[model samples]
Target: MAFGIFDFLSLIGALGLFIFGMKVMSDSIQKVAGNKLREILEAMTSNRLLGVLTGVLITTMVQSSSATTVMVVSFVNAGLLSLIQSIGVIMGANVGTTVTGWLISQLGLGKFSIASMCLPIIAIGFPMMFSSREKLKLWGEVLLGFAILFLGLNFMKEAVGGLQNEELLSFVKNVDYAGQPYIKQFFIVLLFVAIGTVLTIVVQSSSAAMALTLVMCNEGWISFPLAAAIILGENIGTTITANLAALIGNVHAKRAARAHFVFNVFGVLWMLAVFPFFVNLIAGASVDIFGADPMKTATGIPAALALFHTSFNILNLLILVGFVGFIAKVVIKMVPSRSEDDEVFSLDYIGSGMMETPELSILEARKEVVKFADIVRRAFKYVPRLVTEMDEKKLRYYTDQLEKYEDITDRMELEISSYLSKAAKGELSSNGGHQVRSMLNIANYLERIGDIYLEISRNLTMRKKKKAYFTQEMRDRVAEIAALVKKSLDLMVENLEAYERDIDFAKAEELENEIDETYKRLRKEYIKKVESGKFQVRSGVYYSDLISELERIGDHVLGVTESLKKDNELIVEE
Candidate 1:
């Protein structure tokens, strides 16, 4: 019964299979009910109680709390969920995750152990994968995932059972001291806690970690209390996945991940203070409820382990639920918001998001576009102010701000384009691809509008530097053109935001034509002013730059509108 390299590799391979099964199963479930899941999560997580319930329900259905937390983080990143709402869901996810332990208790350790049922399930599932019907194929995938998951667990259990390594067992047993019981117990618990944390981090799935712990306990490799300590560490380890996901996210997203870590670590902290007593309680409950002593292998410890996992989370939630606001405040302090002007560099959403599902990815991309449009609108609003400011200091301030806005738009376009390019690699419907292409084109146009603003800002800077200012009439004409371009931009955004339905497009075309006519008329009038010596040539040149940039911005805005209109039509045909 030697634990050789092949045995170790088999164990690692088994863990990989378990993780793979979890992924496949989780993804299929999401695909089967992704829209409904979104609707439920959005509609149900409005309050603390509903949010908790939504978390529990979603985690239980998907059989993975990590998936639920990642989704919640994605929602926050997408502006679909607030930080507070996310906190509530995260708390409930802690409770929901225990369901996996209970499932293993029944399926992996009972008379109908998962090991015994894996092949029959796979036999039933294998034919489903080949079904022409999409729904049947998805169902087949789910069944196969279940079978593979159990097979992996069984392989791991068998591998550990074969490792009757006396040296390892002796070290585990020697930690207890007869004269100093509390000291000995404390150190052992801490050691197991560290072990559990490392194990969960390496596996990246608490469910798999829990399964392995149960297998070790079932084989008498660890005591029930020791397993309980490891389980506590698993709670802390599970938070790492969400935190890793939040790295590319905005401040709010980072805060949500921090909140998750805070919640779990607090749960583990309090549990450690009363470790022995709590384990005893769970061990007693296992015997009373299941007619089996958890410490004895023949009676089964999986039930006791599951009970402990559930009770600990439930009690932890009850104790800390009232302080969610306090916890949120703490995380906010840990990660504060950026200063006003400094905050304009990056996109606010779609960071650390799940792009495995193209449908959801597209929705996130659209939100980023909406944010992009709003930035462009704000930048345009500053145009007339830039022109009218007479104080040199204020004029310089305005131009500098506009320049920053242009840089912001450029960064946003690049980041979002990169995101969409990755999303395009995922499976998508024809309509989905069309929508993505349109979003890319719209981003390009919006970026061009930002360039136009920069151009206008530079012209104003030149005018200010040369002591050449617009005459009242010239200012009035320029303002008129700016107002028309502003109108076109607003219309473009409206079309972009409601890109699912049919847009008039006629109104947008009319606006574009009017802008062109106005530009021609303004050019003619300004040239006459230059010829009559009513306007300085240098002033006319700057005026021509401003007017031409405004007209081109109108054209780009129109391009965005047309792209939206075309995308909407394609969606309609679908």
Candidate 2:
């Protein structure tokens, strides 16, 4: 029978359905268990072996290795996981992904019609998905997605079986390279391996590729060995998702993805070297131990292939587990760190598609805010240096640092605020929601503080360009106010850092009072000096602007401390 356009469309539609169902199921599950997944990943990936276990658990729970590895890359980008730990997790993801093939073997090939089985599931899930309650709605989606996944598989199986390409089968069986079985078989394996890799890359999902491979095998369109070779290629192809995710990330993220690629490629290389032996071992175990019949290729082949997938990953993991350090080092060398790696103004912990875990995203936002505070502190410190520097070159250098810092802080505030806003729209507790508002306010105040720093730099630049010389008395008084402003900023960051802990709110209030008093005293003293002809009136004008901006910075810092105090109280009440 000829493969026609209708059959081809049916096949493509089935594949599309399968991919859609996978995304729905994976996303719904993540919505249901995102916070718990975050906690488990954050806590469990502390060491190499534990990281592997965490990877397996998360991939199995979410039913998507690509998701797990992408999350791992995000975590590494966020500085949540080290390179070695990420490698371990990547290894476990490979093993955990094999679970999908086994599940298909059990569910897709049963005596009952998998497609028909999906009807009741969708029937039951449809109403719940649109229900008023969010919890029930999420669960309903999971059920609907499960039904759709298997329904697609059922369609694919039927469509593939309908191909009736007996000529193709005959061609595969009759192909020989001058009667050299080994050479012919080797080329066959290599050809299918390339096919598998391309299929996975096109779909961007190894589980999908594995399902298609199993379906093809179930129809005896390909032998089990060829299917296993495809599985090997799928492993290599699966790394693409994480690597693609890492493209917008930092050096550490790039290294983590490279480690994943390195690990899978190495596993494939070794498996290729021992290809025949590996296949035979898995084949023997499937027949003798798992009750699968080796002579029967069509009936028991999927399970045998599943067994091959599992065993290959497990053995590969065992071989590479001990060399995680070496792998990490190699990837680090491969992806060298750039100066901007540490200085780039982007969110490290939060990324796109992470709003599902709102509470967790808050934590990420807070981490970014902490980094923001540090940058502001550095920017503020340079203000005084710029004020005192008389050398043109030094003044320009300090001014540029302040300008860069202002831009960084501005971007950081926007990024963190945008993340929080998105996360706030998700399911969150009242306290979590309130904390988001408070964090937003804090980011706003921090941005204001950054603006004030930039303003100070501008004023200093203007004074330097005008060649305005301050009286010794005016300079000394303004320095005192600037010092007090620095103290206030320091207290503000401290309160934020120890948020939810019993903080010394009074100390922050004290710094604010000091800033206020210093500004007032300096303003009065400088005005008197100008009136008494001890300082130039132009000098007093610039000095007053400087002290006023310093006072404004103090005000914003106090605002941050106040927000932190409220946020802390809410945490305590909860």
Candidate 3:
């Protein structure tokens, strides 16, 4: 049979179905274990070894190294995982991704085909997908995804099977490296490796690329050595996902992504130098383990390729694990940090794209929220400065800063709210949904606090314009209330940074009460002073407005803490 356009389209459709199934399974598993996964990543990455194991575990569960590496990059971006810790996880992900090859070899292409049972698996999973329980529903999706994945693999096999005898494959069949010179064989392997790299980059999934390589090898279109060469290329290509994700991330995130590329490329370079020896070793192991020689038979290629993929990554990891710190240093040197002042307007955690699981995305959003709290707290400092400055240029400078800070707060709130809204639309647990709602509320409150600061600055500006100078007593009273509001803002930030259960709202509430009492006392005193002609009426009006704005800021600070508390309660109820 000729390999016509429809056959090629079937190949493309099968690949798409396979990718969709992998995405569904990966996303559903993440939703099911989102919080636990976050906790695990946070706790387990303290050391390099544990980090690697965590990487392996997560990649195996998700069945996609690209997903694991991108998650690590985002975590690094969020400041959840340090660069050194992320390096270990990336290494483990390389090893963990080998599981997919083993699965395909042992199940899909093995003597007892899992594809035959795919329909039955789908039948079992379909009803559970509608369950009210979130966990059950997610698990159903996982089963459905798994079934769909192998079904696509089965279709891919049939698609490729049709082209086995086509003239198009004749060129591939004729390219024999058996008797080529050493240098010629080396170049041939390099060509195959390049082909693998392009294939993976085009598909955007190394697992899918590996499936194609294995399928082609099984159908006798490619030899074991050529297939192995492509596997090496896939390793290099998989790092592209993390690098692309890091394009919008911060400096550390870029460094982490570069570290993945450096580590994988270094592994490939060393492996290429000993390519023939390693291929022979894997072939020998395949004969011992599976009682089949991949070099001489088509049926043995899948298992041999799986073994080759796993062993190569494990060997590369063992060789490079100790140099993780060295790799980190290399990448750091490759991508240096700019000035901290330069990053004032940019986001610290959240990036432009949804690069990871919804859980990790939420984690990034939470970090950005903490950063938002800090920004407002810093902006509040300028208010006191604006109130007390006497030099016209200095006052103008402070006012400009306040305006800039207010603009930053507005942008931050909008960006965070938009990111959270997108996340809410994804598959989230009840707890995650509640957390998103809480974060949205907190961002609004923080922005409002910024608005009040700007209002105080405006009041101070107008008081100066009207020649309504405050007496020393009035200035002292304004400073006193400002100090109280400052303390409340500080407490609000602390509550935001703390774990929900550990967040003590007592201090925040106490500060709010103090600000309210002080506002009332200060207001009455100002009215009495104006009536007795001790203070100018114009000055008193501005003073009273300042006190009111400060009081309103206190209310907004309390709103942030209360929103967090409410979110915690909602999660517990679920």
lDDT of each: 0.83, 0.81, 0.87
lDDT of 1 at 168: 51
Residue-level lDDT tens digits of model 1 in 1-574: 5667898898788888888888888888887775888878756434788888888889988889999998888777655577878999999999998998987879877667867778898899889989998888888889989888888888887777777574655666445422358978788788899999999999899999998888777777777888888999999999999998898666777888999999999989999899888888887878888888876653367888899999999999999888889998999899888745433444556753455598799899999998899889877877899888787787777787788788768867876787788888899899989988999999998888888888888878877879777888888998999999888888877877767664669999999999999999999998888899999988888889889988999989888888888887787888
- Minimum summed lDDT over a 10-residue window in model 2 is located at 171-180
The residue-by-residue lDDT of candidate 3 on 1-574, one tens digit each, is 7899999999999989988888888889888887877767766534779889989999998898988999988877655677888899999999999999999999989888899899999999999999999889999999999999999998999899888778977877778887899899999989888998899999999999999888888888898998999999999888899999999777888988999999988988999999989999999999999999999998899999999999989999999999988998899789987744223565667644673678889999999999899888877878888777899998997887777678778878987998898888899988888889999999999998878877877878888989998888988998999999989888888888994657888888899999999999998988888889998888888888888998999999999999998998787777
Off by over 4 Å in 3: 341-574
**Candidate order (lDDT):** 3, 1, 2
- Distance (Å) between predicted and true CA of 174, model 2? 5.6
Best by lDDT: 3
Which is superior by lDDT, 1 or 2? 1
lDDT of 2 by residue, 1-574 (tens): 7877898899989988888888899899999995888777666534678888988888888899999999989877665566777888888888888888887887886444467779999999999998999989999999999899998998899888877565655664343422457767677777767888898999999988988888887887666677788898898888899999999777888998999999999988898878877787888888886687533567678888888899999999999999999998899889987754244444456644454578888888888887778678767878777767778998887787677667767767876787788898899998888889998998999998888878888988888778787766666777788888878777777777877775789998898998898888877877787889888877778888988988988888888888888877777788
Q: For model 3, what is the C-alpha lDDT against the true structure?
A: 0.87
